[model samples]
Target: MAKTLSVAPKQPQSCAALLEKLSSVLPKGHQFGIYHLSTPPTKTDALCHPPPDQRPDRTYCENHFLAVTIKSESKPSSSEPHADWRPVIVLALEIFIFTTAYSSIFFVSKADSTGYLHLLNLPKGTPSPIREVSSAFLAYLIDKRRRKGIQTTVNLFARAQDQYLFPGSIKNGGKHVLDDRGLVKWWCRVLDPLLEEQQQKQGSPWQVVKGYLLIPGLDHYETRAFIPRTATSAANWVLGHPLEKISHYCQEYDWVPPRCLIPKYPDDPKSRYRDELDEEASNKEQNSGAWRSVKTLEQFWEMMSFRQECSSGRMTGFIWVVFDPKDAEVNRGRVGGTPMPNGTPDQAPPGTPSRNRHALSSATPKSSPKKTFGSPSKQADLGRVEQKKKAKDKKKKKKILKGPIIPRQPRIKTRQRNYLVDRPVSSAYYYWPAEGRGQKIVDESDYKRCTELLLRLDFATLDKAAGSTRRWIEEVGMGSQWGLDVQGKMEMPPAAQGSGTAAGVVNNLSGLVRKKPIEGSEGQGQNGAGVNMLGAGLVRKKRKESTDGAEPNTDGSSHPAPSTAEEPKVNMLGAGMVRKKPKLA
Candidate 1:
């Protein structure tokens, strides 16, 4: 008979122990347990009603025990075997969720309903297309600046909004929800040049009109939308450098006269303390010599670089300069040469080996010292630094001689293409001093014709805001004959052809014209019969000439020439006679 074995059941661990044990055994892929809880089947009940053998796991409870089961990966498999890349699937899902959330934040924060409408109107799944279009637009702006030898920063979103919105709306606007902080800052960079141009035009004898920086955007409360920069920074950005770095560059370079001269040795040992003397001497030398006179901006840069190089002791001649091994490899197996760093120059830097200087010449200046393991490398470094300094100075001087490498002003590229709206063009026409002449009104007929032509012209452009000139012409009431006729109302002829509004306008114009000689006194003549006839004729002639294009020569033979001694002084009482007695009278 087989030895009797006790069938005692294994003891259950405490809930805490069981939980810890379960957590450890469960693979990350299998962390999820059963989907829901249900009443457990008792051991006796299982005997009466057999349990379903298809359950994945035979879970145990106080009343029952169950067996573990394996799951099939797929419903249909060719070989009845499938690979479950659970880890990969789980990782991918996590990444998808994270990416979606991140992208949503950028779009959802401040987007206007109109913006969404616009997005919807776009061909479905158009973000990719829009991005392409935007990229192209940005590239065009960049290329435009480049072609003009300028650098600028542009924000496509802001430009797009500007194209759609009216200037007054933008100016007196509330906050926009979709203003991206980065994009706004970028816009400021682009607009730097325009602000600079404004500053230059209206010389800041007092305060300058800083710039039109939008104060409210999505984060208006956090950061101001627009800010002005020094003219230098503006110019730099227009030329394509980052605005933040522009100021740092300006501070580094001090302006003065230029001369490439050897450093002078002091006359005494105490020369170290003679900075004041050196400054005075330097100034005096610079002031006296034509060589030192720096006329252009480039020369100022050269002078500054020269000063720095000299003071830094990097101006010593020919020392072998080794860059990293990678640079050496790039230079075609050469280990050392001068590193000629300079301001923007199209040519290859000086001290570069392509110009044919021996690599051995990169050795440092000879100084007597003990032959030690560490010394040569240290000497080599010193040599390289000295070489770098001289090379830098040479490059700087070359840049200076090139003359005003940076343009004096920057240009602001217009926003994206748009059609102008709402605005109309108008003008105030009257005679004033001509180009060093007496005065003449512009051709009223021609002006009227231009106004009419403008009013009827079509302005369906890709850039609506950009087509503002069209709007300006329209809003200002500058158009064809009709527009001019309306303006003519301000000074209607004594006889108006039409009645009602047009006639009223013509009457108004007549009134304005009749208001008279302003503060100036009228012409006078003798009181005799001859003077009366002459004065009446003159008055009538002037009135007729005002409307008709009857400009007369100043030296017309109608008036008598002045006698040299008496100089034909006007009679004060007659000259003081005013025209068009005031209505108040």
Candidate 2:
């Protein structure tokens, strides 16, 4: 019965002042009507429940005004409809914490260990083609090229590992330094082959160049001899890495190596090499825009020319003249003292003179397989027999292939239903006529066939038939709205002729003829028959068929009349086509 106080939600004051007034204003049960304080402009509704009998009557006394203030510092309810207030302290504190965290932290990927975490922007489940293709290419190269020299072999192995393991890491300044023990293990395993090759060629020109190449100006004068056919084979296996991955990585990174050195022929002067280098620089950069490397081993192999069991090619900047085991059948068997199978000629060691004296005594003669065949004269006969067998096979193949029948697969028929067709004739093409009278529902087979036919017909006819069909469609509660008959040539029948109600008649007839439409005498009436005849007339008219055969029953079903209906006098629309009406009994 006390006045309802519209106290603005709790207003804030200093802590001490709030406490001093608490006792005086605390509500009801105990000392005062005081409650918590909040900021200005908020509504504070005091929760006033009816005083219970257990409490004193002083609690009901309205004089104890509860200071139930709405505080700005209180947390908001998650379910609250609207809370727009943000205190200055909260805003300042949030900004301070965010700035502190952001400055102290850097984002790290969950895939940091995989080295390809940067490619997360790419869609998940997409495989990296580069890694697989490069690895396959490496295996193929090694199996084909057997590099002998330790230095070249070790470098090739190192390059392969670099390409496969880290891929694009080298271009980004990642050092290739291995741990102390790892370095020793690598040198022993990979470097031993090259060192032994070096040792074998100690007194040769290889040793001379090895020492002189380390000196200053003489470095330019040092000659690089032809890589032994064996050595070249091994070098090709390692080239796959540079060709496949490095080109793309370097091209993207803009880290393409410059062509600073030029190779000279064995007899060409050091001056000539330097001169060609200068001319190359002066030629306005012939190799600047295009890729200077082959970019792929497949390209290298395609460009290769073979010279006596070895394949070699100059790919823009670098010249790799090499041999591979796969390239020659004879060399594969002969390398490393492996014996050639019988009937293959063995080349005498580089420059050894023929030891005819030792060969004659050591030779062991045996009769040839041909000599043992029956008689000496029969050898020629046996050769003829083999030749005739080959000819017979050729003749047999020709006869069988002369006119062999190849059965072609039969094509499955698929009819395209054009739902978007806007033709008048298409409307009736796939139409489902209304259920027969007295039948509760349409026959399933009939309905399915009709639906399918509608699905297959041309769009234009469907467009024309749609008008009559649309009404049938609705009455039947069929699948869709009547397709548009954009041509608008659908005409009212002569029975419904000149009647202002022809449109409604057409709608009724169309509905009746629509498959599964309700069976009743409604569309069978005179109005419905007139509309149906009109539609049939339009179809016959379009095809230039005689409308003479079409007659509408009292039920509006269109049936072909064999010359029984009387023709009404009508205007001639065109050749042999007259607009006429049937005699109604």
Query: Which numbered prediction scores highest in TM-score against the true structure?
Result: 1
Off by over 4 Å in 2: 1-585
RMSD of each: 38.3, 47.3
Task: Give each model a TM-score.
Answer: 0.17, 0.15
Report the Cα lDDT for candidate 1. 0.24
Model 2 C-alpha lDDT per residue in residues 86-195, reported as the tens digit of each score: 11100000000000100100010000011222222322232222222222222222222222210111111111122222223334322243432343233222222333
- C-alpha lDDT of all candidate models, in order: 0.24, 0.24
